[model samples]
Target: MAAFTASVIPIVSFILITLAVRCHATALIEGLYCGKKNCYDVLGINRDSDKQDIAKSYRRLARKYHPDVSKESDPEEKFREVANAYEILKDDESRRDYDYMLDHPEEFYGHYYRYYRRRMSPQVDVRVVIAGVITFVSIFQYMHGWWRYNDAMKYLLNEPKYRTMAVSKANELGLLSKIERRKRPKEDVKADEEAVLRKMLEENVDVRGGYSRPSLWDVMWVRVVLLPYTLVLYVIWWFKWQWTYFVMKQEYTEEDRHYLTRKALKLTTVQWESIGREKQSELIEKELWVNDNFQAYTNQQQEEMKAKYAESAKYRRYRRYMKNHKPGPIVDSD
Candidate 1:
């Protein structure tokens, strides 16, 4: 019983180790549904806040929480978060993406896919373990294949059919005396082809009686190594594509569209200024823009209106409500 228990322990340990590795790989691939950390709250600002306000908030937080300046336990972490939030809010395109993510939190699959695409990589430890495991296993498999090939050749030389062929090759290769002529039953004539090749190996000749042994490339190199590695990598890409499909298939609600439109309207100062006056008027007439800058007819008045809309009570109320509201788990449409 003790012997049996000892023998089973390693098998159980091996299975557990495999499960841990697979779970880690799957976690890296599937990623997490985003948590409800409001970026606006992180910066102590509202969504309607303009670039200047964002810059000001970021500078204040950086001064307060910088690891060098603050004695807080997680000053560096808070500093990093503040910096990230500022970077997003400072740019029009990135801010829009963030707004979209907040509005449609159920659509996190796409964001996670993009995040893992950029971030997920085999760490040094994982790579080292995988390399060591594959190397040892592959060497064992190769040696086993080599031994089996030799055993098969010895088996073949004893067969009546191969005895004549192998003996002739042995004589020609000056190994006839070294060859052990075995007279086994005729039933053993049906030996594996690899065993026939072994007779040539014994003769010290490169060719297996004029037929060559398969090169490493032609035989088990990929089967023992490349195939498993390729399968693991393919899992990541497969899960990514599956999640992308899930994200795209989700229907956009009216509220989602509204928030997206509002985000689109909040163009960067540079973006708004670069547009022609006629095009700006065209946008205003379409009612797609709600920026206070575009509320004015002239560029001079619009420039004065910058950063003022973000301070309004009504906009702040709306922004506050959106930040506080949390969506539930996403339901599968299918």
Candidate 2:
């Protein structure tokens, strides 16, 4: 039994490792453009279209699809695609990379890596690595905890003191006679003791009401020991695990593909408009316009709103005004 239990770990680990690698590869491949439309296709031109032709096509599409100018329900999204195509084709350096990616997609395995390395240093996504570590730890903890608990239970059941306590408790619960009926003539003492312990466990009452001998759970203090870890695990599971799993599943919708494309191009949402045109032009010149200070501006606006509302005279007065209006007495529904 011990050998069998020990063997299962390596087998399970191997399976998990294999699945993770496959899932990761699938996710990366999903992000790469495969048999999809290129920038030229987006601008209604051929790959060999010169700058003049590309500019003309882009301007026509931009005017037609611009959210502020168009009345279509989804014009903003179309405009985003057109703008991204224009940005790539307009730049000489980026255009070359884009064209290379289009022609040799198999060599462009690192879509996200290339995109990020251009703006920042080359490093693995800390979020993905952290999430993977947390997942592995959580699984190991669950399996190890259960194993320890079972081992502790088995040890307590064989101890003479616990067996006596369990027998006494079994009498109170009217299970002593059931255990007696199962006893065999000239049975091994250890086997007889184990049968009695089994009957006691079935009644869900630990030996000596768990005062003398701790139950499997109490012996490990699983809840107390795991509470903080559980909270952190929950946060990772909620925020990171869902997205990671979704990517690994390799089920790309049209919207998902578009979002990934935008990320590869370093485009934030229409929120870029908030950065003002002059700053936008400067960032574009530096190749930083796609995802420039848009998020910082948004965070700053949120903080300002919080401070404004919190310090407002109306809010202060409202708090004091509510003091005079106490909640009325409760009336029972029954």
Candidate 3:
């Protein structure tokens, strides 16, 4: 049984790695792009079309080929495509990628897949890894810290109020430092003292996604003390193992591709409108009637929004925690 468990993991990891490669990192782009050459390609606009001309062309085509009024054999299909095209040409990132593709048109299908993720992803991944490491190390450190806290805890334990107060202080310091998020619902935020604190503590509960163990424990067998170390080592192994597996199993299905294409198109439209607005804004600020700021501002806003959303998962978790935890503790001096 020990042999089986020992053999299973690496074997599974190997298989997962193979699968990741097969999937072609679909997470990067499986559902994050439109295939049209550019926003212009989507709307059937010519390369020579100016900004106004492009807009005019889009409006005209959108109206003439609208799915609602058109009765051609593939009218709806054609109209949808037209709409999809227009939407993409109108957005910033989609349009930019489309433009980049135009310039780097030689990029093979494989290279094109990278469009699914941004360069900042690596930084984010590193941050998360660092956070996990910090959490694990601190946990073990506290385990060792246990010896020192023995006396302090005994003193504080006699005063239930102090113990409770200490927990509250830990909770608050944890929050103020932004160590983690509150785990309460918005409705529960307004609740009484105990209820709120309880909710907040709930958020800090470590949510491990699979049967992931620690990383510090990776070592040759026969040592009981190494078992705990195995947990830490397991963490590091699991992460690399998971990454390798994911990379091996990366794949994008037809439907996933379709979703990405549609989303990219819509994003493109929003980007274009944003670009136009920034240009107009720039023109406003300038004594001269120039719209040079159009591109810069559009790019800036898209970047900002993308960044905000990129870290949104963490933000939401923290917000929930804050809303749940009560501010202070109730102490009874007996």
Compute the lDDT of residue 190 as modeled in candidate 1. Answer: 39
Q: Write the per-residue lDDT of candidate 3 for residues 239-280, one digit (tens) a residue.
A: 865665466665544444433333433445334344465553
Top-TM-score candidate index: 2
lDDT of each: 0.62, 0.63, 0.54
By TM-score, the better pick of 1 and 2 is 2
| Stretch of 10 with least lDDT, candidate 3 | 205-214
* Candidate 2 ranges beyond 4 A from true positions: 1-36, 121-334
Tens-place lDDT digits, model 2, residues 153-220: 67767778766777788677765454443355656555665666766754563323212233344323
| Sequence-dependent TM-score of model 3 | 0.25
**What's the count of clashing pairs in each model shown?**
2, 0, 49
lDDT of 2 at 111: 58
1-334: candidate 1 lDDT, tens digit per residue: 9999999999999999997666433432222321245668889999899989999999999999999989888999889888877865786756776666555545547767644543464435676787777677667766666766655556666667766766567567665444344685444543433344355545543333213343465344466557878799889967865665466666434444443344557764445545666665555454443455434434654665655657778878877887898676899999
> Model 1 segments beyond 4 Å from truth?
1-35, 113-334
Per-candidate TM-score against the hidden true structure = 0.25, 0.26, 0.25
Model 1 residue 19 CA deviation in Å? 35
